[model samples]
Target: MAAFLGMRGTGDWTDSDMRPKNWRQGVLWQYPNGDAPLTAMLSMMSEKKVDDAQYYWWTQGIPAQGGTVATLNDTTALADDFTTGAVAGQTIYAKVALAVAKHFRPGHQAMLRDASDYGVDTRGLVTAVVHNGASSYVAVKLIEDENTGTGTNLTDCDNILVTGSMNAEGAAMPSAIAYD
Candidate 1:
């Protein structure tokens, strides 16, 4: 399993701006209290790069605030069409409704799961969107973290949720926020 890399510290518990002096790339700094969930406000900052380019971050929680964009087609065979019978490092082409094709764009983070059981789920980064008149697909490169099932089980991926996105390096900030 992959580990979350960062510093764990103790403080006065009142400083809202508390953070580690050294911030490593790909490390999500989470401060947890003994036997309880985080009770303090959390803030994060990225160190300035040598080139000074700017990057933006956005996040959406589960039971997505927006309406459903699409769901994995029930008829497709998961092993042959979606994943390589494993959870991570495979590029899965998830079939979705053509009507919602416009919402699955590259660079988006997609979270998929069975509606009845949330534990059977996976999250991946959208690498491509193929739109056909009758059928459409979202090609997602699976992120190696936080997957719960084999990911090849068709019944385990009945819902699709786009949680977040990351633009290309040096890309300008988006002018607006749109949710589907």
Candidate 2:
């Protein structure tokens, strides 16, 4: 499938939590390929963005096709043609740290600031949440608008930030404020 991107946790392996481990290895995150006809293996690995470095290691040999998990046993890039002829069905795999972007929660809104050289502040409901291993991140759909009237107040937990305003009941940022 072209333009299809997916990531899953490898908790059953040596790096169970998916946390950045020892020195250089932390820069590598495993992506297992599930059952799907390969069409964009070459394009995927080249698309990984890591801060100012696009030189993130890409395995010349992609995992046997299925999905990201194909490289679970071996994270090395293979010399197999996973996008061309008979070997094109091989799995795709790669890894990188999550420090690549400003993280926000799904269905939540935030007054954001540009952490790097990127597009305008993207604000909208956190749409989809993807769990990598130890942490999870959400995808945001931009909602072009501004708040004018009273707004909902929020609190934080485990680093999930909430608005600094008070609740409707005049209560301060409270964890009891249910997440919408």
Model number with the top TM-score: 1
**lDDT per residue as tens, model 1, 73-156:** 323342343432445666666677664556667778887667777666677887877778446777767785434454445435
Please give each candidate's TM-score: 0.48, 0.22
The lDDT of model 1 is: 0.54
Q: lDDT values of the candidates? A: 0.54, 0.29
Deviating ranges (above 4 Å) for candidate 2 = 1-104, 116-119, 134-136, 145-180
Task: Supply candidate 2's per-residue lDDT for 53.
Answer: 40
Expressed as tens digits, the lDDT of each residue in 1-180 for candidate 2 is: 222245333233354564533323333323334322132223224343456543454435422211111211111232331221111122222111233112323334432222231232223443444546423243333344322222211110012222332224554543322212
lDDT score of model 2? Answer: 0.29
lDDT of 2 at 17: 62
